[model samples]
Target: MKNIKIILGLVFLTISSIGFISCEGDDSGPATVDGPPVINRVTLAINDSTTTVGLRENMYRIYGENLATTKEIYFNDTKSYFNPTLVTNTTILVSIPKETPYFDASDELKVVTSEGVAVIDFPIEQPAPEIDSFSPVAAGAGEIVTIVGSIFEGLESVRFGETEAVIVSSTSTEIQVEVPEGIVQSYIFVETLGGVTQSEQAFGFKFVIYDDALKEGWWVGGWDGSEDFENTEQVKRGDFSIKRIYNGGYSGFQIGNGGAPLPISDYSAVKVSIYGEQNVGNLRFSINALNEQELGVILQVEEGQWNDFEISLDDPALIGENELEVFSQIVIQELSGNSNVIIYIDDLGLI
Candidate 1:
């Protein structure tokens, strides 16, 4: 009886050991996850590190549970493409496509998975408007001014410096607004749902010498037969630009005022737009006494493209020996011994 009882005890101990081992090793893998994915957070990589911003065409990491079976992703209802290789059970790597619309978007990032769909708040923005060029850069108050650029959709405001003007019309690539007083000589600004854009070029000039026509109190020397005060062929700013054909090297023109001297303190630079037909020698731009075309600052000229020269008032060559408040003369002469060239000048002014 004692031997039989010992054997029974040993068998019972062996059975308990096997049960313990089976309980500890029962995990096959992370058990087949069931139910919808739970989005914990979303993150982005910037500078090869981690940051967070929903920029178009930027890669992002979606952190959640049971996300390995992601099937589709939508940025504000615009379906986006993703790579399956970058997906995992707890995270997904995806990129927001550029074609996704942001203007008037729902701002919801929706992810569709095999288990279920998960929607999260993802803020996006439209691209800022780009100002390529604006027509009638110089216009009077109440005049219709047109702005040309891209991504002008959902415009918010159009300011000609400080005062917001009335938008006459708006399009994705263009906008027309009425010019306001006191802003005709300041930089134009545009705003949209995304952000604001300031024009690289000012709207209108402060004091004009020649636009469609020469302003009052301004005159041209019209030196020799080389100056065509009105040339319609390659007008840069307005209906006309002073076109000059250099007879040879060192030939140029001059502009002066009889009674209207510009206030030197009110301006910071002398802006002149020039379009060159060929590589001409440097232009010596000078401000001196009436008819003085001898002393000035030298500026390089480019061929086949328009160059805008804003000779600042700080340049010693620009203000040498000349009265500041009585800035009336402007002379442009080519450097010594330069070849013959043709050039068009427009928007000669003080700003």
Candidate 2:
């Protein structure tokens, strides 16, 4: 009878010891265990399907043996937090931390217990950065530019053309950077740990009216026997610009046939770079082709140097009595002396 009683007491002690293995609310260190931890499978916390990769800030369930006394869990060497009560002898429910190491990862999920540690193959990462558009694409060096997109959380670098830009500020959706020097015309790229993303269009010209030739349904330009539109000698923004001489008698360079007016509501100014052959002067600059709708302003130029002009859309001279809804066309004529004038036009667009 005494032997039977001893056996009963031993059985009760063993059961109690097994129950105490969880150490409820006591996850400060590894628990006392009998065998090494074994990780069999990993799955999402909300379902039972197995998974090979885990996303940051997402909960996952690890199924294995000897996991009841789990003291630590790590994904890609990033320590993760697990609830003590949520751990069992066969499973551990934990969430991967947001600051997990994304690059150069070991791609392993490890579970540490009192006896030994077990690891399973796992890849953890975040979504790659994306680019929607950039504001004020036409900007000089040392100017602040903005890039709008999604998933810019882990910004590694931002480049304009091949030059690297200095990040002024950033958010999950937008990033502001200072334009680098020597960037004539190039695309914008934003890189992160996930991947690199390139912009949809080139960075410089937002709405290119003309680069090498007429664009965006421009039907007419340069009237009265002006030289060819494509000239490679005096190039500015792109491969070439319109560098030619016009007839002396009231001859002008006219752009557009008034088919579809330029949408200038979003832009603040009309930007263009011009260079003159000789010591040029103020010329007749009008917004339209017809005489009745002409609002002329004095367009100034210099000799032997390219000057980038930003004509304000709200200038009183550019908009006379008629309110300028959009920029329809432009007419530039040498009215200073009426002699044959040679000029070069390049990088025509809106700012």
Candidate 3:
């Protein structure tokens, strides 16, 4: 009986030892993962960098396990320049701080994590559009002027000083905007996504208000034949008349036939009063210089009331060798169809 009891005790001790070894084998701790924290997405918001406007708020999302409750965000470099705030364990909210070295539109964003550091490739672009030039600078207050310049693709607003001009239309390279009311100054500036460009001051003086005596030497002409010489004229009242004819035909007026062309070489232009009775013919106005003839063509007339026209003659040839003469014969001709339309002529001058 003593021997049997010893065998049972020995068997019980062996079973307990085997159970302890099995428990030790199953004691492996939790598995560990090795890698950088997975980032799902990153976002940024920016205001116009060119102007004094402030920056806007934006978001960036981070994903994966082991994300610490505290984190750091940066821009451009890892030196903690952005100083983003930790909103949550998996998210961060940051405001773009005032740039030290000046904000560049090409700057990017980056983030740091407890697992590792990750960078965002997308750059933050915030720029103000600019305008280089505006056509018809002296337009009426309500006139539509075309604003031209670079980087007009994303225009936000256009302003004429304090007043906001109405944008008529926009394109990648150009924008058509109308002048606002209560604008007295001829000079103005245009604002865009890039910057502002100043416009040349408009000539606000009324051109037609000048006295008739001030226009003593102006020339006037038209191809339509009228009973009164002064009524049917197209070119402004100036020294020379340039008329155009159709189908290889020619028409012109000479200031002085007796002298060797007018001698005044520094005259401004030939002025005439003209209206387009028809669109089929062109008018040519020629001036006789001592040696060469300078000529210009007028094709901007439509059948209507008389409009004043001016053509500059800076060329040295149109003036005569002696004093300029006023008793010159004006010639007219039809280039194609002999419409027999006569252009009127009056008030020809050199000044």
**By lDDT: ranked, best first:** 2, 1, 3
Off by over 4 Å in 3: 1-37, 43-72, 75-86, 95-109, 113-115, 123-129, 132-279, 285-351
- lDDT tens digits, residues 276-339, model 1? 8764768888776422534578888887887777777667776665567667778887775556
| Each model's backbone clash number | 0, 0, 54
Per-residue lDDT of candidate 3, residues 54-117 (tens digit): 2223333433333343256555442333333444444444555434112344354455666677
Output the worst ten-in-a-row residue range by lDDT, candidate 2: 25-34
| TM-score of candidate 2 versus the correct structure, residues matched by position | 0.58
Worst 10 residues of 3 by lDDT: 203-212
Which regions in candidate 2 have their CA more than 4 angstroms from the true location?
A: 1-73, 76-115, 118-129, 132-145, 150-157, 162-166, 178-185, 191-197, 204-206, 221-225, 263-266, 289-297
- Candidate 3 root-mean-square deviation in Å: 18.9
Task: Tell me how candidate 2 scores on lDDT.
Answer: 0.78
Across 1-351, the per-residue lDDT of candidate 2 in tens digits comes to 999999999999999887788566454345445599999999988877899898888888898888887899999988888888888777888999988865568999999998789998898876678789888867766779999988787799999867899999999889999978655468999998778889998877556777788785676666663755689878886687986576665667787634565666766766678888853666666675533355666778887888767666677677676665677787777766646678888878665
Pairs that clash in candidate 1: none
The local distance difference test score of model 3 is 0.46
Assess candidate 1 and give its lDDT: 0.76
Better of 2 and 3 by TM-score: 2
